[model samples]
Target: MNQIVTFGEVIMRLSPERNKKFIQSNRLEFYFGGTEVNVGISIANFGGEVKHISCISDDFVGDTAISYLRKFGVDTSSTVRSKLPLGIYFLEVGAVMRPNSISYNRSHSSFSEIKPEMVDWNASLKNCKWFHWTGITPALCEGGYHTLKEGLVLAKKKGIEVSADPTYRSGLWKYGADPKETLSDLLNYSTIFIGGVNEMNEVLGSDYGDSNEDFIEAGKLLLKKFPSIKKIFDKIRTPINASWHKIRSRMWNGDEFRETTDFDITHIVDRIGTGDAYAAGLIYGLLNFDDFKAMEFGAAASALKHTYEGDVNFSSVNEVMNILEGNTSGRFNR
Candidate 1:
């Protein structure tokens, strides 16, 4: 396999120690993460060659973030430095009936200041087989949108596969871009759609329910509108509470629809990057397995992420394969 390239901001996450609210803790622990980088790191853990592109502050904080990605085997050579500060978010981990909360302070951060000239996409995308992007990048700044669009257009020309995760957050779209229009336009360049009914409805302005039938219809309509999309994969989560959840994945590959069994996660350690884990697993599986098996791999990877702490899923390929093989006993491996 060639390189997998991810484009997005690297955010600094500050959280109060284990299950404690901000008010209850005197100090905060920090970790580096973002949706795209999280996926990159997870793929790297699975032994994929991944290159991450982004702008970080020209300071120690940015240095630490680069070191963090390097520690996870992600290539950060394309990551650039800016005089702006690094983006930061505060997360409040929840338990049982409680819920996690987040506050962002990233508007003026280094990533938001990214320009198209900052990254030489032609060189960064060299030897790249797959490119991954999320809607959060475009929502940040106009420059981000243009930069990603430049890469997408080139990726299409180069015959590279593109995965689009349109994680539309209304709050993040404060930069004056039409969320629906922006996402719809980007979808034209994407080869795989990585979202569910809600994202579909948001981008298409359709009122689709959560039933399987509704999902199938929405997916078909999506492919009809965006002819470039070859398949659709969605990760469905049934959250019982902050501590436990059930996850499954479904897919529509042009002619057939496939779904996976639920992987129940009890006593969740962290829920931050479960979706990223699913995306990473899907990418890896698609590169090596059939569509149905890839969807199952994605669901299992998502279930495994809840067992680990922080924003990146550090679970190896064997760990994810164990879940696929029905070895969820959390047994000690000596």
Candidate 2:
């Protein structure tokens, strides 16, 4: 069986209890989140052999993250335990005209202090068919960028297929180096490019059009520029309100662009890590199927993420298949 390994920071999300504001709330719900780590958990939940590689503090928050990943069947052997504490973020879910807000306090967390020598790249990626990562990892700090670059180089040297999601977070890139310089350097090693139009434009220095059609065109241009990129996956978002959203995705498979229609979700319990869920679904589809149906499958899985609360999507293969089969009635089970 093929195995996938993902590397990035794991944050402990502290969100206001219920629909209350952070200042008004006394209790906060805790959840484990990180772009690449969330993808690993989703892939593992879908029956994929997945491993998460990152450094976390030996603190309680780090332990919680480890326990959470283990519960989802993710291998933690590659995780390094440090004396530093885990990073954390505060989330305020929005309603009505207000939009969701997040405040981060992740300055010198264990993951940010990850040094290249701390990771045994050869051993971590051994027997792994696919190695995955995100641009956020490189934006953490100088050490973080070095760790990501080293991991990618090792994976390439071992002939392991690499997938990267240049998921740009402006706040996260507040370190010394600019994201454009770091991301451009990293893109040279990526086989799969995943991100939104704005993110691609910012990282690749390409003129991505504003509209979705133009975005697809820009993606095609990117594939032309980088011949090594076999596939380009993109997620489309249409916000109805603070509590409702329509999400979908498109893929340019170096030949033709395939798209899935917008999935209108009524109630959104949590919306933090939906993009990672979509990426995981896309990877699964690319590895398992050849047809364009993968786009729809990926879109359905992302839509299902809105119904649940937390960073990692808790969805099963059967539920995704049911949605793909056009069963959106959402009948309750006994």
Candidate 3:
């Protein structure tokens, strides 16, 4: 019963080789990743048993995607197949001051057709100790919301620890469901909140400033409103530019506040899925370490993700520990 369960869409990502724009590159590289899948894969890479449940197209593309997950040691037994095509998004990786741009083509994809009846929550969460989800799934469509709600309800009944990352994306909530209401309902079943002040304010509809004091007040208020939430964690990033950024994390465990020092990443290979990396690290850390150390591990994992290309964070636990030990010299390994 120590397995971790992740539920979300599995998307195909296409990007031009190098930092070139779409107009400059004739060849494009592809990777299979989704927010929850990235987290599951990263946790598996860290030697944690993880299972990802999603609906993928019944085609060669879907076959490759499932293979990719298995290649990272993630269990895909819960994955369902659909006749529709798989969802895809294109990325134009940026450098320096230029920012990365993404265009999504997932509106009518296979994952969008997911229904509550399509998944057996009881079976999917079997032997599960932790469950992870994000706002992205619910934002996709009405069925996505209902299906996730079903899983959350069952996961709560099983007494599994649930982590909610309410990534409010206004653009994706085209299904007419109120974002705040949807997220607030899901939070009732979640034990951990893996997002920051902006995310808190979005769900709470409160206007809190960006200071430590404000964060504390906001966290306290959030826990009060949603009594199920035992801890709140946030990854703060200060971007000097698209390629250079500083990252740190903080947490409020309904008792005390803890923060970590800034980690400077002067060169970023790819920024996609870094937040998922943070969430993955936090999930793995909480299962093994104390609250504060978990937050530190999450921040370190996020910093390391910036140095990798593609959508997944491939850093091992030892590699993340090296970052936590302040060993960012990038020296040769014996």
Among these predicted structures, which one has the highest lDDT? 3
Model 3 has a clash total of 0
Candidate 1 Cα lDDT to native: 0.93
Q: List, residue by residue over 74-105, the lDDT tens digit for candidate 3.
A: 99998899999999999999999899999999
RMSD of each: 0.8, 1.5, 0.7
Name the lDDT value of residue 90 in candidate 2: 89
Name the lDDT value of residue 181 in candidate 2: 82
Task: Arrange candidates by lDDT, descending.
Answer: 3, 1, 2
The stretch of ten residues in a row with the least summed lDDT in candidate 2 is: 289-298
Quote the lDDT for 202 in model 1: 90
Candidate 3 backbone collisions, by pair? none
